[model samples]
Target: MTLPTPMPDTPHTSAAPFASPSAAHAPTTLRAWVCHDYGGAEVLELQTRPGPTPGPRDVLVRVLAASVSSADVRIRTQNLPRGFGLLGRLAFGLARPRQPVLGTDVAGVVEAVGRDVQGFQPGDAVLGVAGVAMGCHAEYCVLPATKPLVHKPARLSFVEAASLPFGGLAALHFLNKAQVRAGERVLVIGASGAVGSAMVQLARHRGALVTGVCSAGNVALVLALGAHDVVDYTAQDFTQTAQRWDVIADTVGASSFATCLASLNEHGRYLSVAGSLMELLARPRGTRRSIGGPAPERVQDLQMLVDLARAGALQPVVDRTYPFTDLPAAHAYVETGRKRGAVVVVAWPEP
Candidate 1:
């Protein structure tokens, strides 16, 4: 696949350079999961495709690990807005995924760098957004140096690093939007899920006392992730409790706006990482009216997450790892909505 022309190099900022990996023989052809229709994970098929050529400022990464998220599932099922449908089909290919690949959050070693690229060479260990472009569920995925790509933390393995980006970014964004502070009480709904689990830790790292809502099975897990308290959603509704929270981070969108609002302290923020098609479509109108609501803030949040990871204040809670060939099963497991943490897809053959 051919990438867009690279962007001009800007003055080197204070940001740290990506860590270069050990060089290895590069492959010309790569295996990837491709999809022709909008449906379940079954629609995804394995195929060989021409490896992507990096434009100036781009790095071609040999994917060692990737992850499946709810966003990928939505795209696969055609459950997003009309624009997503139209643009996804047009940009990806109508009637099927234009990129055909599914996994997004990626962690890998760089295979080659574009001519104009700086800070990254032929071999670099990195993690970043896959955007809506090249599918990361393959042997290689390309990302611009200017994108959210950052050096992988030395403490994390490729699979662990791959699981962090999307959920970490989303959780960080919502927590910041909430402006949680020390001693403040924060409630995280769906706290055992990928993004929810991240919120549990990030909020705690910010010094806020966090209460996580999840099933009984995951209460212990949420607590282990740094939540000060855990509310079992199956046994009781958190909103009915006497405790008033300064912030409510709803990752599942499982509760109504009214319920969330009812639980919040005065002038408290209610942030939702997951939203319906109607909510996304109505977002612009809400913004135009100066009414604050859930918004999908991406790139900037991703950068913040990288900082936290580098600082050792945040870490991914990866619940399961699947071989690349079992991507279908991974997708199916994610759809169950019971996953305790991020589901990782490891591209490298398991030793």
Candidate 2:
């Protein structure tokens, strides 16, 4: 839902008293990273401001931890991939980001629920993605009960649970659309990334012969995630090799349908998780087909990811963790494009 009022364009300097994270009663205001402009990490300012109120169908959560993803970086810097510039501006904002608190994946304890909410109550540990609502990068966030919110399993901590939704959800959506089958030859490009890592594990668990293409530094990490083979993209190009795959999934914008067409086997499926505009608009040429678009944010998918994590089938690779106050540092680190897996922020530690 669009907020009724846009946050102030000026910095907030009021030192008025506000409830701490440990407070029992609901807080009228909460601390959050607010970005009023489209720029680098420097644009993000930590300020104490009014928090969002839960509507009749909404649930308010005390955010324990949240993951800083590529999506967050893109929105913050307005540095989307080529061909997505206009789309990004239109969807986000022409002058600035539509959502100032830029985070999608969240893990925390429920603090309050609207009257119409069900199956969740105050004090329940929960984890889910806010998706385009994107307010998880704060001490508290509101999620609609009908969204992807679900109970957090005891096996995963706040950070680990925070790592699952963004990557795992996208991986699950693409894999399902591709209809991956047991014993099929599957190749995941950029296998060290959030989505790639999740796809590696999920594909392996589906009994596919999974091959991961990544830099040499992430080869062992991909192997540990159950990929049968690792193609060091630094050493050689997997597409130029003689190997053919039934499914070729590009988690990063490394390869497109045209580039990987000849490398695909008969009836192969190509998944473009971060597709360029041309790639998204391109049609299937031959026996192989391509799939690309926004990944659906489904509660069922989030639940499946949680279940897989509980069963040890999905392992969330968190490369680094940052204190909530150091979220700008986290954003700077992610901007380097070197971090593997998720970059998590401790939103507010458990009391």
Candidate 3:
């Protein structure tokens, strides 16, 4: 896990504004927003709790930022796609939250590491997916060092870093499932949303001719984000388009499997993050498959995201930023399903 590194007297220079909670009246136990039961955002309650310490292969991170994604919403609402209720309850909780604090996307600094850990030291800025352990919405959280943890790229702010893990990983997974290749034709439905937006950029980065489907208002925005062509779903139906795609990735399940099938060229891939029953039934159609059952969590993929961001090929889309304490409003806004991209929560306020 954590490679051996010397502890620094100061946090990374850029992270100075995101001062650790331990700086002021540092308490042994940290304040955490906890979820005891599954319900709406109202189920969340802010309470002081004992701080988490690193395990032998884990690192304790002072959370600087976290993201409110569809997974978090699903966990809170107990709505785990169709037919996944039992499995979801098993992984999450039967009647209550298995992980109490439901946030997976994390951008933070190493506060401490376990005895067996290396490659990290106090004040090292880092970012990664916390997975189902879901303890990111707090002043401090412990993360497995073996996962996709990496040093935060110098180019992105904490909010931007927070935005990448969930959406970026999902998009990367589905895109790879589609096997996007150079000179291929890629179409991304729900292009204005988080995963779809990342899919557009990654497909383009792979040298595909990218087309994006979104609302009329987001047409220019999608185009600016590197979509070769923009389809306004409000005014037109993409299923009726003349052009065919080599890979059809639907992030919001806005298009049916039949529509995606008819729109795809022979042997093309149809990927969906949110799949309908019809799409699930269409899985045997040879080219159709539903993605996002599990997210992509490979460290190499995380490194690719960092490299793309550093090279200015991929940019994290942050629709809005909410203070860590305003999670209720953040959840309420995400429920509206109108966010342009990712919504971020700043766990640690800027000093």
lDDT digits (tens) for residues 55-109 of candidate 1 = 7777778777788887787778876533356654566557777667877778877
CA error at residue 54 for candidate 1, angstroms: 1.4
lDDT values of the candidates? 0.71, 0.84, 0.78
**Every model's TM-score:** 0.83, 0.92, 0.89
Model 3 worst lDDT window (10 residues): 1-10
Clashing pairs in 2: none
The runs of at least 3 residues in candidate 3 whose Cα sits more than 4 Å from the true structure, single-residue gaps closed, are 1-13, 16-27, 277-281, 286-292, 347-351
Ranking by lDDT: 2, 3, 1
Best by TM-score: 2
lDDT of 3: 0.78
- For residues 221-248, what per-residue lDDT tens digits would candidate 3 score against the true structure? 7888899998888888877878888888
**Candidate 2, which ten residues in sequence have the lowest lDDT sum?**
1-10
Give one digit per residue, the lDDT tens place, for model 2 in 74-124. Answer: 899888777999989999988988788889988888887787888877777
Give me the runs in candidate 1 sitting further than 4 Å from their true place.
1-26, 80-94, 277-304, 349-351
TM-score order of candidates, top first: 2, 3, 1
Model 1 scores a C-alpha lDDT of 0.71
